[model samples]
Target chain A: MASVETTRSGGDTGLPDLVLRGMTLGYLGWMVVLPIIALGFQSLVAGPQAFLDAVLDPQAVHALKLTVVTALVMVVINVVMGTATAWVLVRYEFPGKKVMNALIDLPFAVPTVVTGLMLVLLYGPSSVLGTILGTYGFSVIYSQPGIVLALLFVSYPFVIRSVQPVLLELDRAEEEAAATMGASGWLTFWRVTLPTLAPAIFTGAALSFGRALGEFGSVILVAGNQPMKTKTTPLYVFGEIESGNKQGAMAVSLVLLALSLGVLISLNLYQRRWSLEDGK
Target chain B: MKTRVQGLAFFFLALGVGLVAGCGGSSGPDASGDVIKLGAYSVVREAFHDALIPAFQEHWKQKTGRVVRFEESYNASGAQARAIASGFDADVAILSHTGDMNQLVEAKRVSPDWAKNPTGGIVTHSVVVIGHREGNPKAIADWSDLAKPGVGVLYPDPKTSGGARWNINAIYGSAYLASKAAGGGTPDLAAVADLLKRVQANVVNMDASGRQSMSSFSERGIGDAVVTYENEILLRKREGKPIEYVVPEATLLIESPAAVVDSSVEKHKNREVATEFLAFLTSVEGQKILASYGFRPVDQTSPLLPEFPKPAKLFTMADLGGWDEVQTAVYGPKGLWTSIFSDQGK
Candidate 1:
């Protein structure tokens, strides 16, 4: 790693470095920045009053609140379950461990629509389990829980993948020292290991939260898309666009885009801080 | 590392060339025949693709001694209208309602006088009705039955579905007409709004489209009843699905419009073929094909009319003061239907 860094720094002034940098920035500007600017412009095209009305519409507000709440729920669950899965993968020797490791990424590969359909088939009213649950006055599909479930499925791999590498590279020396000092396994994890994993956990949580905010395909199927009830922001945006309320669609979309941008930027800053502390 | 980078560049270049070649292959019109692009609502896709297009092709060939190819595009009505208005370049537009067609007119893609024809430019007709599971477990007979407690109903969100607007309009119109009859010509807006709110409260799922609502009712078995077009239920039953529907005694008539997009027809030099296609849609042969697909023909005297039972108090948009008034009263900002959802959230 040191040698590679030395070579890179040695050639930092070369034509290839400049070309690569320019190409990356140019590609990113065209693909990502340009579209975001266009969306920003369109959202304000009808003037600030129209933009405010669209954003402040009761249905839009409810949809935005629902999306944020569901995404938060998904992020909380992902952080706990994902950290445990990563820990188990790093510390335990179990049958099918290799397969389980690979399976963690299956959610990423599967189309989000298929993910929604799978959830619906599993927990929809027609299924036996869903029927039993319904008989007990519990429904999953076409309700709030279904929205969270869909969000969870689509964002499942974020935390696990983010924390797994950090867990793997973690030295056991600190954990052993804590153990020698009469710390319990859970205590050692909390005091010695958890601090090291905190940044990674936050990274995963933020990424999944960002991803869950924009999730549509799976959420739409399971959400039932009742305005001010089950509809999330993305679905609301879709409804607005289809209904010819283009201003409302653009306004809500800008909110989501801003939120996702905020998450990524914060993640970048947090990681930079961590790296600076590591350099110390 | 440098060689790897060069290899990656070459790969991307090859992929770009391949993509360009693939796109170029299919986009050009055939040299030997004329092409007419048809942008239509999704519900008419089966009728057009399976029967109308082929029949028209044969007729045109026999009459003009030239082969004419069709480029078909079908989407939900509003989306299709928006697409054509925003330059989909479809030579013809067949949509679910005049409101969508009006959108094209406003965009100047279609002429305002497109409706100056024998059928008022409408190609097909249907009535809003209630679709239920076989055996009529819910005993749903009218719009008010959908508002009954403990009965789950399905309809698409009107914000996204032109069909949902029709469904909701049927419910609202039935109530409004009843109030008008009782009050000796004064329609009670409050009663209409009340009925809409009650039915919406019973709606278990508001799918994105009418087709999705039907699937949710039939395939997923989620709802006890579905408010949809009469043609949708008939089409399903004809496809061997065990579904039954009831035409409410008082329901709104669904008149779907079609027209030659003047801009696109002129651009494609397809005025003659496009004009003929619209003419054929109202002709006896075209009406028969549409009727076979469960759509009520615009020509009330057509032989296929016998298959469609007439509702006792059938009402067109004119009964509610036409599309412009209905749009503002039912679906506009602060509209009755729009406010119902917001009021529920409170």
Candidate 2:
């Protein structure tokens, strides 16, 4: 035990360093590295041609385009609404403020399927509003609009939660000092407040975008799942599985996996740069 | 503590591996030595879970000191097929459609001849039609009437629901009534196909399951008329809804076939008993039980009918050239159904 400790601590000659290195490598290999390797191997056997076929299918292509587009659009909408929501909650004093603040997170508590089913119940063609929407030729369910609505419901909390802390940390005295300098309300916010909030808002939006991309339970119920017109990538994968297509499910998962990883890595790099800048 | 952790880990690992190996032999807890496991659709499962399972257990115990059991997952055919394809363990699967069984055949879990047996055994079957809130206010008498202005129709997706296909076939038959050149008395397949195009337009919701669709339609007032099995209509009507059913002219017939799994058929060591179970399902007694359960019997022309009987040669799966042909003609890309309803009934 003493000898092993001595070698491990490099107290004596370091001849067994190779063994230590191999052991360290093995731990990571089994835990972190091997599962990724297995995923790649499974994808290879699940028919590379079929994967390509599924991704390239006209229906899937449209769904992918719609998913990415809706997710991005949702992230943009939520960032503004969510940050404002957080700003109001953290920076205000009013009656019923706590209730209003908690309501922002109502979306998070609702089961996604319930969210979707509720939306249809409220706005489907059969509902009163649905009939009005139908009368106006502006349907929400069974259309692209419903996809965005579901995405927004699930993605709203990411921004509100992320922005709230950063907003609370914001020195309000700076705004007061800027007001003393005769700076306008808009100018005080733009110059003093916006930069600090950007990082947090972006982080929230990144998470929201990813959540929207992978969401399944809610969107299918409301989207009407009309093949090419309203089908999302997740629905397409589900349909393929039902059609006895395994390779297609893998391919769809690969696309989702690749996009999520890319966004997360880019986000990490982004936050790293911002932190470095703040340090300097 | 470290040793204990290792011991727990080893035990769980062995357990997991054992469970995976036991996957194919999966039978319900009620299985006695002489009985076989049968996976069933909703009605059969409802019976097994609520009534038949206990009865079968008691019957076998009293007669031969054995028990019959079932492992059930009851819902839409498409979901069931996907579950089976993803390695849901079952000795025998009785789904709402042959399409699901075909999935098992492709997986090499069941054989091609799984449907052939003494019963030609349709465990349960039903007539389907438009169900409305009392008074039939829209006066919907036939399938064509479903397209009337402001007629909000609710039906399950044909891709998923076995009963939904009969609705599809009924719609096809009605379309031919207006245009025989397309497919009608002269058996014009093209005319029938063309007629299906128009009916596809008025559909509001393409629900993935039958039970939920019916429940929502009745319980939540989701639609004006519901497309579903007569059994479901009967079940729903019993739930105190103001509902009435209208069977369209010359509506399509729905048939459900069931047989013991290939391995069970051969390996049960008592083929007589196995065959007897399936045989009992088709006898006059069995047929009567099915009728009482809201199913249409095999004999179409019989008196005291609960619903329409199975149609003749004109009403056959062979006439449509099997499931694959149906998929190609109606469900595939460039499919007539898609081309017609592309804009959702525009």
Candidate 3:
């Protein structure tokens, strides 16, 4: 609390402190706030009715719905798989464990477009696996599943990274006490470990969901980009802008920007509350 | 501690100033020589970069006894037109269709009467054709064949690609002609919509640009046929890629136009060179190079004209009541083509 207060006030309202604070805030405002304000102004320039029309346009609505649904699907799978990955990394020792941990962050480093291309190479209609899946009538590429798959790849590291540190730092004494009290291993994990990991899992899920919402490069290649079908919101915005419908593009972009901002703001609030509880 | 904070602040301020300066510091045309910026659609990238620009530089140098460097940019036709209209500052603009050119005119970047030239501002000619695998296993002879069940098709999304609009227009136009013939001079809009819907249903993927669609067809092997320009398939063949294509019996004539962007040329003081470059593209020598690159020459009298076969029932934008009418009738909200997706729910 003392450290927090000192950092908040910067110990003194001296010239260097004011200069540092002003510069940081100015940089953020210039780089981030300005563009968001510009987008909002452009979309609202024609009035709220136009903005509503653009957002509610059947094609636009369909794109927004598709983006949200695919992201949600990705989040559900990521929560399960990512939690399992973190669990194994922390609770077990194995060969190549270090290499596996390093490789988990590779998805974040690789370009999203390359991620899209890699996925297409593996699951496109002509690939051996894709052809095999096609015979079963469960096509992957150029469909909703492909969209979710690309989202999963791009957001793969989010949940795992968030949960790993929490898992490592977790106090094992409570689980041991539960086991010594006759609780089964699964029961101990559910009653003791999961509650501690829930916040980290939620943070990871929220972060990945926000990331997936704006995933353009990877999803655009796999999604067939059929309007009212595979086209996502970012693709719709690009199409509108390229086709000289700037108003429509701006309106849809504003919607996405607002959605991502809402997610990040709520995550911040949740983390702040959780940290306060932890401090107690 | 205070000095460290001050140093960090100075560092950030300098970084900000440097970023701003870097973005604004692009050099203008050099005074010792002339330069012309050419903004064109993506399909013409190979032709312009490899053949036309070098040929034009030689022609300009021989005529004026001065070096004329060219700056080139190629994008989807509509995107290219939007770029030029929004201050991209290209002295010359070559696009896939008049509708895109008209966008520049409306923006006052080009003269309203820019098409008043020997070639009506059109520098190249092509036709909407179907590109299939070698030997054409599916036998996609016409637009109707593309609508058949189990026949996978590929075309770019028209909203982003001007070439895709032409491909879709060809299908719609052919269907319109058939409906007109059956209705004894009255075209059936419903029939055109039905055919477009069916073909759209079979489309395996719709990439953002025509080049991407061609790649999806040739490299990915995702579709049985690709609705694209004849010149695209010819260019692939020139590269020794085994590709087969068909010129549909009734197809829309693809007229690609080039015009000097008045605002850009005026700003760069490059009007003279830019004007001459457009003139050269229609000249017999220029036409010859374009023809070699698979573009149909605009000048019908050029010897290369015979190499391009005429379609049985060739039609123009005017035949479909011009670009403005077609834009509204096909692409506008509630237009036939636009509504097809909504009604079919695909």
Ranking by lDDT: 3, 1, 2
Per-residue lDDT of model 3, residues B41-96, tens digit only:
98998888999889988998899988899888988889889889888999999999
Error of 3 at A178 (Å): 0.8
Candidate 3 lDDT for residue B51: 92
- lDDT of the structure predicted as candidate 2: 0.70
Candidate 2 residue-wise lDDT, B193-239, digit = tens: 65565455556666666776777677667667888877677654444
Tell the DockQ for candidate 3: 0.61
Between 1 and 3, whose TM-score is larger? Answer: 1
Tens-digit lDDT track for model 1 on A35-60? 99999998998999999999999999
| Candidate 2 docking quality: incorrect, acceptable, medium or high | acceptable
TM-score (chain A only) for the predictions, listed in order: 0.95, 0.85, 0.96
Considering only N, C-alpha and C atoms within 3 Å, which residue pairs clash in candidate 1?
none
| lDDT (C-alpha, whole model) for all candidates | 0.90, 0.70, 0.91
Better of 2 and 3 by DockQ: 3
Model 3's CAPRI class is: medium
lDDT score at residue B156, model 1, on the 0-100 scale: 96
Q: What is the TM-score of chain B alone in each candidate?
A: 0.96, 0.75, 0.92
DockQ of each: 0.73, 0.26, 0.61
Q: Which candidate is the best by TM-score?
A: 1
Clashing residue pairs, backbone N/CA/C < 3 A, model 2: B182-B191, B182-B192, B183-B188, B183-B191
